[model samples]
Target: MAHFRQFAFKQFGYFDFYHNLPNQLAQQDYKSFVKIVFLKAGGHVVVDFQEYQLEQDALFFINAGQYYRFDTSCIGTLLYYNRDFYCVEIHDKEVACDGILFHNVYEIPVIFMEPATSDIMQGILREIKIELAQEDSGLEEMLRILLKQLIIRATRIWKHTHQVDNEDIRQEVEFSRTFSQLVEWHYTRFHTVAEYAELLHITPKALNKRITRYSQTTPNEVIKSRIMLEAKRLLAHTPLSVKEIGYKLGYDDSSYFIRLFTKQAGASPQFFRQQYQQA
Candidate 1:
């Protein structure tokens, strides 16, 4: 395995590049430092356990520690670099993508793109390619800025695609981003919408409204979904028993957790674990 403690980048000019990918790239999980993809062709992808089907030109953003894979061979430009290369978390206030574009579960991973937008993205990557070819002293810094520009463009699209037309745009995006972080912190300890509402210092109605505006789901639904995503990840990757997994998820009664997993995943915990492990 290659440990990218410093930096790395690549441009897959054609589907031929897929031949170089190892089988584990598709079957096992890995934490990507940062990955940005612009696909001229269409295909499907599975990030974690959630599957996404892409049928048009699209741009994708994957942050560190998220498991993902391309489902089929397609023409695209793929850029991946390590955290040591450009620490987004350290400069998060500057880029503002840590929550919204990177670790955002509320937002979709794939952004459908217009042809003109696609052309512009391609142009930026091409410029980055040129910079890579030249051994310029400031090459890394240049790539970082280009990466920032690409992320900012994608952020605009996410806001546009998910925002309600008449709302205060900044407030909506800000609230949702904050709320998502809150959910991550509190989901295990507090699972109710009202509990989260109190934490956000808002009424339950306001919380639900915010949740719906950004994620198209209620507060409780988002909370449960987050819990369910964790459950699936643990089952797929860990050796803990189903009862133990349930307990780890904060359920006192394992059966209740089993019901919740079955409801959200369309299969019992054991079945899901067996199927995924065997796959």
Candidate 2:
């Protein structure tokens, strides 16, 4: 059975806890807000054409504008909040999950919690549920604090998993985070490593060296992957032709775009789109 409790403050903010993912999301303007989904019962989730097995204690972060859906039969809790409630970019200093948890390019945005950590997170969710049920003058502030706590805790877990254990490692993570953030913001318009390196105020060689220190994928590969992912998303979901999609991704030459996509995705765009749709 699908069950949910939602708290919305007009256009300012919104929050909800869903026992089962509802069909209304298909109609909901999902691109307008950020989401955190925690699975208490094992299930499957699909985000941006990628499927993930959601075992107990697994948390998935879905950035705004991403394609998100799930097995509505599974038991889980979903949290939704818009920028007006608590902007991740503006408050990134407080929680530090803007790029690491949400828009991360090198890592999948899912966190697996140990049992103890899971308990702590569950407790925080309980507090949020209780707070959402109340009516008080400080309701907004309380919910924001709770949301920050959740993001902060998740960021810590992600850092630990990614081996951000020391100052040097932390710096590497920060640099990688910044690079990933830049790529996310400009992947549609910029496709070259040199361009991103210029944006980062570093030489291409230095940028490659630093990024490779944090991730096995080179900076160019990262950019390519992001572009390919968006291409795949459009090809799967939109009726746009291959040339249009290529042009949208900053490639004026359709054949070159096709070659690049085939090389990176291991399938031609037409084949990939046809196969994905048939699946």
Candidate 3:
């Protein structure tokens, strides 16, 4: 069985990159993580399966469990840290940053800061680099302190820059958050949209309407996408056979599972597994 765990900062590691290459190298699928990137100097970058032309001062935050790849040619400083390092319990008690509280855990809210804002962030990054490089007593404690400060500043910047728009959008965001949490808890046993709706104490039609309004897709599509994502992960990372994988994902009929996988993934389960192996 697959289990999800929260990220903690004390167990976190840091990687700083300042390289320029031509071809892309790393394509990762993270299960649960968070990354904060400060583009000290860069031309073009790709994240979350999309390419963005980055300015020297671009700042971005990425949440866990997202699939991402990057173009190696871009030269920049990136801070790759996991959510486990943040220690959610500690953060909830100690930090009161709206951006970190609302955005960082679930979605990657990338905010483009102005020049003055960039200066403040760069200063924090410089301190973090120093802290990471030195061998000192209570290093983890220092890092956690720096991370909290960073989150506080970033959240302030985010709130100042991007104002909330509408009440409907807020409701949609809440619904999406609830829906994602439910999916995380009950995905294996409850495969249908109606199952999720019943758990949330709402009709399937209402659930579908809200999901469609928020995501531009129906509830069934969201369920299928989450299932397909897990299927791909298991197919790529594990040696389980197609039938076993299907059964693990709550499908009893292997043939029906194969058809559904094919419909959504554009390939049969066997073929998908083979392709991942080849890659």
Q: Supply the TM-score for candidate 2.
A: 0.90
Q: Is candidate 1 or candidate 3 better by lDDT?
A: 1
Question: How do all models score by TM-score?
Answer: 0.80, 0.90, 0.68
Error of 3 at 52 (Å): 6.6
Candidate 1 residue-wise lDDT, 1-279, digit = tens: 221223344221111134234353554233554677676655666777667676767887777666666755555666766655555475654245454776565654677888888888888877777766656667667877887788777777766786635558677767877777788777778878898899889999988887686456777878888898888888887899999988887898998999989998899999999999899
Using alpha carbons, what is the TM-score of model 3?
A: 0.68
Candidate-wise lDDT, in order: 0.70, 0.79, 0.65
Per-residue alpha-carbon lDDT of model 3 for 1-279, expressed as tens digits? 011222342344445554532231243333355666666545566543346776657666665555544555455455555645665554542143223333322334666667888888878877777777667777767877887887777766654454435677766665776687677667778989899999999999999888777456677876787777778877876788888999999999999999999999999988988886785
For model 1 the local lDDT of residue 215 reads: 55
Worst 10 residues of 2 by lDDT: 10-19
Positional deviation of 251 in candidate 1, in angstroms?
3.0
